[model samples]
Target: MNKITIFHNPRCGKSRETLKLIQEKVSDDDIEVVKYLEDVPSEEELKNILTMLGVKAGELVRKNEKIWKDNFKGKDFSEDGLIKVMVENPKLIERPIVIKDGKAVIGRPPEQVYSIL
Candidate 1:
């Protein structure tokens, strides 16, 4: 199996569930759990992930986050700007993004991770 990478936030229920599901499907050594909040992705990494997910930078944002709503909501941002925002404020990034090979999926439903796996 290809190595799987999960951009995980342990505090989020969906993220935890997705990680658990990935754990069951993948070997321990093949699973790469990235606690994205503590170790944020760089701009270039985030852009690559967005490409793999077939989403724009803004589409990957968790718009409901307090940090986003207070600081960035209702504002216009270019693609690069949004990527910068997500890189700087990883909490605003969506939870449990699973990537394998060259594809990625946002695990909003936890089951969504299976698609890329």
Candidate 2:
């Protein structure tokens, strides 16, 4: 089986739930849980994830996040600029992104991971 990776924030309930759902469907060895808050994704990595998720950089942002609202809201950033911001502020990225076999989904509902799996 291919590796399944999840960009997880352990403190977030949705992230934790999504991780648990992935665990139920996949073996531990096949799963990689990323604590993105501590180990942020690079701009390039965020771009790749954006590709996998089939979304633009801004689409992956957690707009409701205080960091985004207080700092980045109402700003018009280029695609690369948004990606850079997400790299610098991982909290602005959406929760529980699951990726496998070149496909990805934002696991807001947790069940979304199944589509990629």
Candidate 3:
């Protein structure tokens, strides 16, 4: 089995649900939970995740977050600039990103992670 890692934000209900679903579907030892707020992903890590997710840096952002609204909304950013912003402000990262076997999915509906597994 492939190793699984979830970038989880416990405060978000969707993130929690994704975590629970992973727990139910995957062995405890195979899954690793990263409390992203406390342990933020570096710029390089975020870049790798974006590649795995097959998405642009902007696509991985949570534009609804106040940080994005107040700081980045309506602003045009280069791909690297967006990645740098997300790295600097983890709150702008979409929740419950599950990574497995070099593929990644945003667990917005939570079930999305199943495909990557």
Candidate 4:
């Protein structure tokens, strides 16, 4: 089996659900949970995960966040700029990104992680 890792924020329901689903599919030992807020990734790591997710920086953003609205809305930023925002404010990054080997999925409905598994 492939190594599984979940970039989780416990406060989010979708992230929790994704964790539950992974438990059903595999043993706990095989799944690693990264509490992203406490174990924050550097800019380079975040960029690599985003690339594995096959999405642009915008797609991985929680734009509804007040921080995003207050600072980033109606503004044009380069890809690097957007990534910097997510690195600086982890909340702005989308929840429940599950990575398996070289592949990754955003567990939006939680079920989305199933495909990558």
Candidate 5:
């Protein structure tokens, strides 16, 4: 099997749910949880992962976050601007992103992690 990485946040319901679903479909030892908030990805790494996800930087952002609401809600920025924000504030990155092989997916329903498994 390919390497499986879950960009997880323990406090996030979706992330927790995604992990549970992955456990059902894959072995526990095969699943690697990257607690992204604590250990944010490098800019280059994030860029490649975004390409794998087929989404722009802003699309992967948690715009509903209080920090976003307070500071970034009204701004209309280009892709670079959004990427900078996520780099500066890891909380801006959304939860439960599952990466397998060379493909990446957001586990919005949690079960989505199984699709690429």
Candidate 6:
């Protein structure tokens, strides 16, 4: 079976719910949970995730986050710049991104992970 990876945030309710749903579908041994805030992804890795998610770097960002609102909001940033910002501030990256077989889904509602699973 393919390894299922989840970019999880233990503190986030949606992320926790998504992980539970993933656990229901697959065994713990098969799951790769990445606490992205603590173990931030590199620029290349972020780019790969964006490709898998079929979205731009900005699309993966949580614009509502205080970091974005306080620093990045109203700023004009290129795609690479946005990626850099996310790398520097992992909190800006969206939560509970589940990946399987090179495809990714943002588990905003938690149930969104089902489509990829």
The alpha-carbon lDDT assigned to residue 5 of candidate 5 equals 96
Q: Count the backbone clashes (under 3 Å) in each candidate.
A: 0, 0, 0, 0, 0, 0
Off by over 4 Å in 2: none
Q: What TM-score would candidate 4 get against the native?
A: 0.95
> Which lDDT tens digits does candidate 5 get at residues 1-117?
776999999999999999999888889889888999988998888898899999999899998899999999989988877888898999999888999998999999887887899
- Which candidate number maximizes lDDT? 6
Candidate 6 vs. true structure, TM-score: 0.98
Better of 2 and 5 by lDDT: 2
- Root-mean-square deviation of every model: 0.9, 0.8, 0.9, 1.0, 1.0, 0.6
TM-score of each: 0.96, 0.96, 0.95, 0.95, 0.94, 0.98
lDDT of 4 by residue, 1-117 (tens): 877999999999999999999999999999999998888878899889988998999898898999999988999988889888888998998989999988999998999998987
Point out where model 6 deviates above 4 Å. Answer: none
Model 2 agreement with the true structure over 32-67: per-residue lDDT tens digits? 988999989988899999998889998899999898
Candidate 2: the clashing residue pairs are none
lDDT by residue for model 6 (1-117), tens: 999999999999999999999999899999999999999999999999999999999888899998899998999999999999999999999988999999999998999999998
lDDT of 4 at 107: 94
Model 2 scores a TM of 0.96
| Candidate 3 runs further than 4 Å off | none
Give per-residue lDDT, candidate 1, residue 16.
95
Best by TM-score: 6
